[model samples]
Target chain A: MNEAEIIQKLQQGNEQAFRHLVENYQKRVVNTCYGLVQNTEDAEDIAQDVFVEVFRSIGSFRADAKLSTWLYRIAVNRSLNHIRDNKKRKWFQSFEDAVKEKKAGLLHYATENPGTELENLQRANILHEAISSLPENQRTAFTLNKYEELSYKEIAEIMDVSVASVESLIHRAKT
Target chain B: MNCNTLHTKMIFFLEGELPEREMEEIKIHLESCTDCAAFAEEMKKTLAVLETDKTPQLNPFFYTRVKARLEKQAEEKVVTQRIPVFARILQPAIFSVLLLAGIYTGIKIGQPAKINSDQSVYTENEMIPYLNEMEAEAIENFLME
Candidate 1:
């Protein structure tokens, strides 16, 4: 079916149409979540959540952009939220547990991450930490550019920012 | 280009996004300036390492899982909406009844004494004589007319 027809079907809450959407964009959503969260299980869980949200609120979607862009936007936002919540939960743990967690070392986080090569694991982990430490906009721009390979114009559209602003964010991220 | 300007363009230079003239200018500067060249190389290496394919692919049944979750959510929504209207408002309905009972009880216990005092004036035997005199005067005036 054409994009408009598919969207109409989705808005109508057609089960078959929803299944089609889930099948088509699942990989992209999952991959984007994985890229942001850096954990296999959490990415999968968040990907499922992204689709569930899409189904629940499909009618409310403004559809001003491509479906895939909106999906990426959701996936990125959700993955970051998952990370933020996890950090907060960890912070709320007892002092002894927090000390133990610190003793476990941050490198352990990378070792368990799926798709990380052992040869470059340390470097990659450090890079991940650096990206995480960056401000939200810079990290998002850098991720969309360096990993997703989205153009500055496309990233600008997805991020709802000017192309020049995206360029500056990526520049700041690099430095 | 100077080192400071070259620093701003290093990312584009590494990505080879600069215009031909500017590219040449930066290249010449990099050739002559060891510190800038080193900095550029370091930035390039950092970016290269940053570009690793670290995001894991989703499992084959990812769509199935998502579909199942959505179905479950939809089912819950349906169930919640199907709740009986009275059952949904049961808590508030019970609270309102208890509140009204308490107010009625409080009024019965705290009945005012001023209402009894008003009744005493209307029921007094002395008012009967005044009422009879007023009726007598009306009859006398009617007979005179």
Candidate 2:
């Protein structure tokens, strides 16, 4: 179904349609969260939270933009907030321990891999980690453009920045 | 097209964001200047690398978990929405009962007035000593009003 039909059904309390919507966008939301949080479990939790917020507030969603854009805006905002709050919580814990655990996990997976596909996956993971390390604004701009394939204008709108600023951010991100 | 201008617009050119005139200019520059051509190629390669870096697919259980959570939330909201009706009626009824009970209690705790030497109503004998001569006279005068 088209976005309008799906949204209309969702607003009418159709669970099947809601499930379809979840199924359709779950990967993108999860990926977006993963790009921000860099942990699979946290990303999953954040993605679930994003959908819950979307469902609760779907009634108020205006159709002025694409549903995907609207969903992305929600996903980005939630992911950034989650990261900010997670950083605060992390300050109370051992940052070194977390980093060691992550490196160990990545090393274990890398050692077990024998195929080129595994190598590519490892590289992608590294890139994602690099992307996550970027300042929040740059990371948000890059992820929205790179993963969502959003136009600079759409990204600027979602991020509440100028098109020129978005362009500069992506440029800086590339370098 | 100047190689300098084309070099500056390489980012936009790669994304196909340039106007037709500028695009034509860049295309012509790419045809002649090896350096600008290589620059465009390098930019394209970077974008290609980025393009290949796909967003990882989420685990299979992700959708199920999200759906379950959303359903649970929706169910909760439905239950919450149904609650206010009963609460609305119950709230006012409870408030009115409590208000009436309070008034009844206040009236029960209170007593009729008794007159002292000053002829002013007193709820208790302790209030008589606090009455001053002028105040007592003012009270007596006001009573006549």
Candidate 3:
């Protein structure tokens, strides 16, 4: 079904429609959450919460924007909130934890190529650190634009910011 | 066309944000200016490296787990909805049945019968002593005051 139809079914409290929505966007949500939270376990948890919130709020969803855009907004907000709450609990963990938690993770490169392992690990560590170190809004804009392949216009809507602001934030992030 | 203007536009040009008409001016400047060209090249390399870095893929079980959780939530919602319907239909019937059983048990217990007139009179008179005790206590306190 098209988004309108799917949304209609969702509003009617159709479980299958909700399922379809979840199936279609779950990967994007998980990936985006993973990017923000940097921890798979926490990302997964936050992603689940995002869907639950979406379903609960779908009745009020106006189709002024694309469904994906709306879903991305929900995912981004939830991820940010998850990070903020975790910070309050003094449980903040770095993106490196995510890389380390990967099965075979950074170690796979080390074991496969003993020569460049140190260099590879160092580069990956630097990149992850840089990404994590970015201010929240800039990091979010950059991630949504780069990793999620969202257009600047779509991101602006998701972030509720001007397209110009998104561009400038992304530019600053790149530099 | 000057170094400062070219430097400022480099990022926008690289991102393809500049208008088509402006592209030629930028291109002309880049051909004559090695410094600007090098800066653009460096920016391109940095952006390229950033783009080429792969985000980690979620585990294979990721979708499976999500689907499971959604299905579970959906099932729970359905169950929750049905609960009220069941209660609405069954509650009054259960209450009526319990009420009837209570009344039946009460009736099954025989009523008290009068055994003797004198015994009933004595029972009635027993409450007056307690009442008199309370009255006497109240009057004594009043008189003492």
Candidate 4:
């Protein structure tokens, strides 16, 4: 079905249309969340929330805005919220809890790739920590640009910022 | 270019965003300066993490899980909707019952006072006349004395 028709069907609460929407956008949504959260499981979980939100609130969606942009916005917001909520847990777990968690996480990664996964996982962890240290907007812009490979203009549209702001954020993030 | 200038432009150069001339200049500087070269190498490795940590694919069961969640949500919604409807109906009914009870209680409390006032009306009138007679008698005795 066409975009308008699909939206109409979704607004009408058609499960088929919902399934179609999920099929079309699921990977991108997960990838967007993954870019920010840097965890495959959390990314998928947040992506599910994103879809559920879209399904629940599809009636309020303005037709003028692209669905993909809305999806990305939700994914980004959800991932950031997840991070914020995790911050408390992280603070409390800064002791031996962190080490145990890291060990558990490393084991999880090791199962996927027996040999090189640990090194790559460690690199990814360091990179994620660095990205997490950045200001929220800079981190967001950089993540979208680097991980999702989105253009500055696209990031601007999703973030509702000027392209110049996105460029400046990314430059700051890189530096 | 000096190290400071090259350092500022290193990110843009690494991203291939700088102009060709500036890119060439930075490249020449990095070729000679070990410090700048090492920094550039580190930056490259950091940026490469994005490539190495490949974007994860959505699981095939993603839609199924979403569908299950949606269904569960819908079910909870039905239960939730039932409650508000009950509350919507119950709230005003309870308020109205309490209001009627209040009015009834008020009327009941007020009735005794009305009854008491009615019963005391004759006594008050009789007491006044008797008091006047006593005063009159006392005045007459005092006048005679």
Compare the candidates by lDDT and give the number of the best one.
4
Alpha carbon deviation, residue B37, candidate 4 (Å) = 3.1
DockQ-sorted candidate list, best first: 4, 1, 2, 3
Report how closely model 2 matches the true complex, as a DockQ value: 0.21
Chain B TM-scores of the candidates: 0.58, 0.39, 0.39, 0.56
Cα lDDT of model 2 by residue, A36-128, tens digit: 666666777988898888788889988887887888788888889988897787788797987886787566434434353654555645665
Tens-place lDDT per residue, model 3, B59-93, is: 56654665677678889989888878679779989
Deviation (Å) of A169 in candidate 3 = 1.6
- In TM-score terms, which candidate is top? 4
Indicate the worst ten consecutive residues by lDDT in candidate 2 chain B.
B119-128
Interface RMSD for candidates 1 onward, in order: 2.9, 3.7, 3.9, 1.8
Per-model chain A TM: 0.81, 0.82, 0.82, 0.92
- Tens digit of per-residue lDDT, candidate 3, span A3-118: 99999999998878987888788778887886787665677788888888787789889999888988888888888988788666555556676445544445653443356445
- Provide the lowest-lDDT 10-residue window in model 4 chain A: A109-118
> What's each prediction's TM-score?
0.66, 0.59, 0.56, 0.75
DockQ scores of the candidates: 0.28, 0.21, 0.09, 0.36
lDDT against the true structure, per candidate, is 0.78, 0.77, 0.77, 0.84
Q: Per-residue lDDT for A83 in model 4?
A: 90
Compared with the true structure, model 1 gives a TM-score of 0.66
Best by DockQ: 4
Which candidate, 2 or 3, would have the higher DockQ against the true structure?
A: 2
